[model samples]
Target: MNITDLMWKNATAYGYTFTRTPPDAACAARVTLLEWLDAGRINPAVARVFPLEQAAEAQRHLIEDRPFGRVLLTLAR
Candidate 1:
């Protein structure tokens, strides 16, 4: 909220350089992410999976239950 919190405390104090990059960088980052996924390097922790039909239930679970990790909604039958 404050300048100290935004710049010094959150960024500089932690030794992290917060910066903004060009929009094209996002596309390149996505490509890199896909490459990592293909190489089986990115293993996301899945909490639970819900079918598309159970979208409401999934949302409710997310809002109320708040399970750890990702709650995936799949369209596959």
Candidate 2:
């Protein structure tokens, strides 16, 4: 399926607008998105963190719906 079809499917399933097309004003939109993120207005739940090497395992956990929030992959410094 193409991007449009995929978007339609998702929108129908979730009852929301899913756009396959890119925004015409991406630069301005990106600035807005960044501002929201920095302002804590777009905070996402963090379920768990794993080392980069365990990313695959984390994905599996997410796929199984074991995580309650977003899973993050961290790199050891």
On a 0 to 100 scale, what is the lDDT of residue 28 in model 2? 62
**Most accurate candidate by lDDT:** 1
For 1-77, candidate 1 gives per-residue lDDT tens digits of 25677665465433322246566886687788789989999886788999999999999999999887899999985
Per-residue accuracy of model 2 over 9-55 as CA lDDT, tens digit each: 77543332226436766656667778999998887679998899999
Per-model TM-score on C-alpha atoms: 0.65, 0.53
Provide the global lDDT of candidate 1 against the true structure.
0.79
Off by over 4 Å in 2: 1-19
After superposition, candidate 1 runs with Cα above 4 Å error: 1-21
Task: Give lDDT: candidate 2, residue 38.
Answer: 98
